[model samples]
Target: MILHIDMDAFYASIEQRDHPEYRGKPVIVGGGNGRGVVSAASYEAREYGVHSAMPGRRAGQLCPHGIFVKGRHSHYAAVGRQVREIFSRYTPLVQPLSLDEAFLDVSGTLRLFGDAETIGRRIKAEIAEELELPASVGVAPRKFIAKIASDIDKPNGFVVVREDEIHSFLDPLPVERVWGVGKVGARRLHQLGFRTIADIRRYDESLLKSKLGAWGAHLWRLANGIDEREVIPDRNAKQISHERTFSEDQSDFEFLHSVVCFLCEQTAMRLRRHGRKAKSVGLKYRREDFRTFSKSKVLETPTDETAVIIRVATELLATMRQTEPRPVRLIGVSLSALVGADAPTQMSLFDDPGYVQAERRVDRVMDQLADRLGDSRIYRAGSHDWRKRPRE
Candidate 1:
């Protein structure tokens, strides 16, 4: 069986745990700054609709009395490590989805650790007793269903779905519970009269495919509990991204474009360090009111060059701005569909070989300078000191 373990309000809960006075009160980590974005919200804060990735200003508006604490990313990472250590005691087949969530396949460990439910209960008890953190666990025969079962009830929840009980358990739930069915997809599903998983299950898969394409067929199978994905241990990084939240909302396109350029450089640097080249570039834009938009483009050829990444990301940013034209709370750049930098790839017929060689030489020199003088001391001229620019 598979067990999905998700920590409850991880960052905010850590703050509350350490600061006894914060208990039972609204706590918003990465809040209090007008330009910042919330990293996590405690259960108390969540009552007012505060959540991770929300603008700090908006979180304050929702929970006026919320306790705002700056995030300690390194410390949280340490805590996450401790949690993983606990998971390691029970099963080596643990696959981490994030610091706060993981999947463990215990089909082989049943002889030593009891059934999946018992092992899950034990793990939850250990986290509470040792770390004073709450977790929700879901036990199922499949991965996606296990994830859904874990989230059905949260903030100290546990649910198990037997092989025989899968359909009855999944039928009544909204289609949104299926992975990849985000707000836009949910709306499309609703438009097609798919309100529940059962609705998707009853509909013809080919018809669903006709409406939603390949994704529709995928969702249809998930609705019928046919996920074939295994709990892969130590999954490689599938994406790399960096983002910056301003001290205040920003509306200046020139300034925003510069920030995107800087972020793209940072992302590209990391991509090169990982010995990978990206086949896709993406932009993440969060508005002052907290609405977020994302756009991405697949490259004609994979690249780890900052120039190519910045150009694509900037184009996407321009596209997003044309539609929204609003003050941005946060902006980010991401690289994905990564392949080894040394991997065989199709060379562009129109490639300027001299330009490519020169760009690589510049990148190598810049990387060396960054290593010796620190990233803060070295930056491309086009990406000015936007972080130090006074908020408007």
Candidate 2:
């Protein structure tokens, strides 16, 4: 059996938990500026048609008096760790879908825990007691059904689909509820007169394949409640990247370089924390009109050193420079081609300069402090002015 746990309005809930005054009111968490988009919306805000990815200005138009708060990812991560700990008590086979959702294989522990439904209830209860947040749980014989069941009753709710009820429960659901069906996929399904999972199941497999290619065949199987995916554990990431959308388009080279340096340091710190090294560094920039460009270089040696990553990133950025300056709307840095610490290494004859080494040491100190005190606790000297000035 598989159990899917999904936290309800995770970010907004955290805000409400910390600030008692925000509870049961419309709240949106994201950029406070009028141009920013909503990162997460409370249930009250959702009732007003506000949701994640909606423009902050549009969200405000939907719920004029809605409270808005900037996201604190470090706080959310702390809560996520607490939730993971609670999940560990139930089964070690927990596979996190995100910081707020995960799938657990409880088939092996059924004898000890009684059944999937019982396990789901216990997990939900523990999360509520420990984190003081609401969660919804869905349990079924397969991952797809389990995920769907969990969404049926949300916000401190639990639902279980017995082996025999899988087909009946899934048949009536809209095609959008299927695993692979997004807006475009659903629209195609709708055009084919397949509005529900049962409709898709009624079509011939060959017809589905002919119409949608491999994806159609896969959707047919999913509609019939047949998911062969295993609940694999220890899914290590292949790359780590961070990007920030500026509140206003910027053309300042010094400011852009600072943001890139900070991102490089952040990615390098994450790689080192995972005991991994990267052989490639990449940079991405988006113009004011949203045209994006990226460049990457394969390093001669794999490294998790911040100074090396930042140097390579700076070099990559230089190649994209043009005579006509354009304002940047977003900036990003990423490291890829990862290898474990136990892997073999080749030494470089030319070592980094003293100043580069010093910068790396400073990055290490900042990383430790950020990990303990939080990301906002430390900032690059000039990056502070990128945002608004404080009243005090």
Candidate 3:
């Protein structure tokens, strides 16, 4: 059996939990800038048609009186860790889809835990007691049905699908409910008279393959609940990146450099938090016209040092300056080729030992300070004095 647990309005819930006055009211969590999109919407705000991915301005229009809070990602991550710890007690097979949702295979433990329904109830109860937040759980024989079932009764609800009920439960669901159906897929399915899972299941397999290519054949299997993906553990990330879209495009080099330093610091903090190091550093820039450019350099050794990343990113920016200087819209820093910190280091003879040692010491001090205080409590020196220019 598989159990799917999804936290209800995770980011907004955290905001409400931290601020008692925000309870029982519409809340949106995201950047306060006009260019920002809604990252999470509370159930109250969702009633007003506010949702994630909606433009922040549009969300404000939807709920004029809604409380908009700037996002605190570190807080959300802390809550996510607490949730993951709770899930770990039930089973070690937890596969987190994101910070707020995960899948757990509990087939072997059914006998020990009574039944799948009881397990779901216990998980929900544990989350509520430990975190003071509500969650929805779904239990089924397969991951596909379990994931969908979890969403059926959201906000502190549970649903259990018996083996015999899978077909009937899926039959009436819209094609969009299937795993791979996005707006494009839904439109195509609509044109093919396949409005529901049942319709797709009844369609000729060859015709589906011919019409939708490989995706159609894949969807045919999913419509019949034939997913075989396992509840994978240890889904270690391959890269860590941080990007910020400015509220207004500008040609200010000092301000853009400060932002790049801030992004590099954020990326390095994440790498240290995960006890990982990167072998490559990269920078991304978006011009006012939305044309994006990126440059990367392979480091002589893996590192999780902010200064080193910033130095390389600054070098990349110098190269970019050789071309026309258009107003900057966005800046990003990324670290890839990740490996565990405990892994052996392969350093070249030409590498500067003094610089490497200084970077390591700086990283350790920064990491300690961040762990004791908070990520935002400390930032790059240049970023501390950055001032946004007024719109023209």
TM-score for all predictions?
0.69, 0.70, 0.67
lDDT of 3 by residue, 194-287 (tens): 9999999888888988877666788888888788887876436678888876656767787778887888888887778778899999988766
Order of models, best lDDT first: 1, 3, 2
lDDT of 2 by residue, 251-367 (tens): 878778777877876788777767888999999886654456888999887887777888899777767766336887778999989888666656566765675568758877887
**What value does the lDDT take at residue 269 in candidate 3?**
79
lDDT of 3 at 262: 81
Tell me the lDDT of model 1 at 127: 98
Residue pairs with colliding backbones in model 1 are 35-247
RMSD in order of candidates: 7.8, 7.4, 7.6
In candidate 2, stretches whose alpha carbon ends up further than 4 angstroms from where it belongs are 235-339, 342-344, 347-392
Q: Best lDDT goes to which candidate?
A: 1
lDDT of 3: 0.81
Runs in model 3 lying further than 4 Å from the true structure: 33-35, 235-339, 347-392
What lDDT score goes with residue 67 in model 3?
A: 94
lDDT of 1 by residue, 1-392 (tens): 99999999998999999999999999998747665667789999999999987877888888899999977766787799999999999988888876799999998889998999999999999999999999999999999999999999997999999999999999999999997665556766788798999999999999978766666788899999999998877435678888886656789998999999889888898888768988999998776544568899998878998878888898998899999898987788989898889866565888788887888888898877665443545678768756444332
Task: Provide the overall lDDT of each model, using Cα atoms, as 2-decimal numbers.
Answer: 0.85, 0.80, 0.81
Relative to the true structure, candidate 3 reaches a TM of: 0.67
